[model samples]
Target: MPSLVPHLAAVIFVSALAACGEPSSQAAKAGPPPRPVLVKTVAYADRVTERSLVGTIRPRVETDLGFRVAGKVARRLVGVGDVVRGGQQLASLDEVDLGLQTEQAEAEARAAAASLRQAEADLVRTESLTSKGYSASASLDRQQAVTEEARGRLLRAERAMTLARNARSYAVLTADADGVVTATSIEPGQVVTAGQAAIRLARTNEKEAVVSIPESLLSLAKGRAAMTLWSNPGTRYEAKLREFAPSADPATRTYLARFSIPAADETVQIGMTATVTIAVPDRERVARLPLSALFNQGTGPAVWTVGTEGRPTLKPVDVAAYEAVEVLIGSGVEDGDRVVALGVSKLDPGQIVRVIEALQF
Candidate 1:
C-alpha cells in the first residue's frame, strides 16, 4: 500500500498538465503573432556633407621686417609677438657713426655754400676789373668757370647731405603696418646687413586659416568654410575662400588654400592650430539606409518597403554611394516608406505581413 494513492494522484496531475500544454505548443508553432523585423523610415533630404581639415591660423598678409640699412643692432624695441603700429619704431641701431656722418655732410654742405658765395664775389670783381681794363677778358671767363664749378660742388654736397640724413633715419627700424611680431632673428649685438630679414610680422587686419587640402577635397576650397581653434574649440568663426593654389604642392600633393576670417579675434594668433570645416552641398536628393536593406532581384539593387497593404515589395534604387554599413539612395523610394533592414530575403511579395512596432528599452 506504500503511498500508491499519492503516486497515482501525481500521475493524474501530470497527465492533465501535459494535455493542457499540447494545444498551447501547437498554437505557438502555428504562429500566434508575426515577428517584428528591424525597419528604417525613408526620408530623403538635400545632400550636404561636412569635411574637417587641420590647419594653422595665419595672417592674410605677412611681411619679413628687415632693416633698410646695415649696422650693429643697438636696441630692439619690439620682439617676437609684440604688437606694433604702423611707422612704430621696432629697433634702433648704434647711431654714433650715423650721426657723425650726417654732421660731417652738413658741414661739407655749409662749406660748399660759403665757397660758392666767395666764387660769385670773385667773379663780380673780376668782371668789374675787366670792364675797367684792370683784368683781362680771359680772367673774367676763368672766374665764371670757377663759379659754375663751385655751384656744381654745392649741388653734389647737398645731395650727399640728404642721403646721409636718410641713412641715419634708416638706423631706427620701424614697422610699416600694424601687426604682431611672429619671429625674431637678431640679438642686440648681432650685426645685420641691409635688407636682412630680422623680424617676421603678421598683419592682424585680416586673419586667415591656411590649410593644405587634398586633391580629392578640392571642392572645399571653393565652398564657404568655417574655422575653430584647437585652443578654444567652442568658439567658431565664419570664413570665406580667399586664396586657393592653382596647382598642388610638389611634396604633399595637396592644394594650399587660405580661408579669410574677417571676424577672427586675438585668440586666433599666427601659428595657432585650427580646424576648417567645409559643408559641401550636392544637387542630388538622397536618403541613407542600412546596407543590409539592399536586395538584388536580378534587375538592380533594391530595398523591401512595407506598403499600406502590409505587403512587402521590392523597390529598386540608384545607389549614390556605398559606405561601410549604409547606402545612399538617389531615387526610387518615396519619403515615409518603411524599409525592412534585416531578413529581407525571408519576406515574400505575396505574403501579407503584420506590422509590429519594435520595442526599445
Candidate 2:
C-alpha cells in the first residue's frame, strides 16, 4: 500500500509540471494593456509676443549755432530751455570794431566816387579840346585812363563796403528754425571764436523716440513698433523705423534705434522718457504644441494623436519653429484634434491609450 501511495504522488507532480510548461496563448493574443497619456485639443491662433524698452524723445533736427565772425559776446538773449522762433536773435557780439570797419569802407567808397566824377569831368573837357585840335591826343588818352582807374577804385571800395556790412551782420547769432534752445555756452562777456558752438537748438516740429536694443532683438527694432510717453502712458503713438545703427555700440554692445512719431503732439516734449513696444506680427498661421508631444522615429518630426476610439496614430508634422517650451507646427494637425501632450516616445501605432484630458490654451 505504501509503494502505491508514493507512485500516485509522483504522478500528480508530473501532471503539474506539464501544465506549467504549456504556452500562455491568451496573453500573447491580447498583448499589452492600454497606455495612460495626457491629451490636449489643438487650437490655432496668432501667437504675438510683445517687448518693451525705455527710450527718450528727441528732436529729428538738432543744430549748433555760432557766430560767423569772432568777437566778444556783447549779450546773450536766450538761455537754456528757451523757446525760439526762426530768425530770432539768440546772441550778439560786440559791434564797435565792425561798425568802424563799415564806416571806413563807406568813406573810402565816397572818396573814390568823388575822384571818379572829377576825372570824368576832366576827360570830357580834354575830349572837347582834342576834337577842336586845341589839346594833344595824348592828353585826352591820359584823362580817359584816369577816369577808368577812378571807376575801378570805386568798384573795389564798394565791394569792401559790402563785406564790412556782412561782417557786421554776422555778429548777431539767430535761430534758423523754430526750436528750443537746449544749451548755451556764451555769456554776456565771453569771448568766442568764429564757428564755435555758442548755442544748441533742437527743432521741435519733428519728434522721434530713441532706444537701444540688443543684437537678439535687432529685428524687432527694424520691424513695426509703437511708443508711449512715460508722462502720458495712456496714449499710444504708432512709430515708424527711420534710423538704425549699423554696428553695435562700443560700450553697451547694443544698436541704437530711432522711431519717428508722426502723431506726437505738444505733450511729447524733447527729453521726455518713453517706452517703445515692439509687437511682432504673426507671419503665418501655425499650431503650437508642447515639445514633449513631438515624436520622432527616424522618418521625421511627428506627434501622436489619440483618436476617439482610444487608439493612437502617428502623424507627420511640419515644424515651423522651435520655442522655449513648445514647437510650432505648420501642418499635419487640425484644430480640435486630440494630441498626446506627454510621453509620445513610448507610443506605437495601433496601440490603445487612456486619454486624460489636459487644459489646452
Name model 1 segments beyond 4 Å from true: 1-50, 129-135, 279-285, 288-314, 322-327, 335-361
State, as a TM-score between 0 and 1, how close model 1 is to the true structure: 0.72
Candidate 2 regions with alpha-carbon error over 4 angstroms: 1-50, 280-284, 287-361
Predicted structure with the largest lDDT when compared to the true one: 2
For candidate 2, the TM-score is: 0.68
lDDT of 1 by residue, 85-130 (tens): 9999888889888899999999999999999999999999999999
- Top candidate on TM-score is 1
Worst 10 residues of 2 by lDDT: 20-29
Residue pairs with backbone atoms closer than 3 Å in model 2 (clashes): none
- Tens digit of per-residue lDDT, candidate 2, span 215-256: 888768646799998889999999999999999999999999
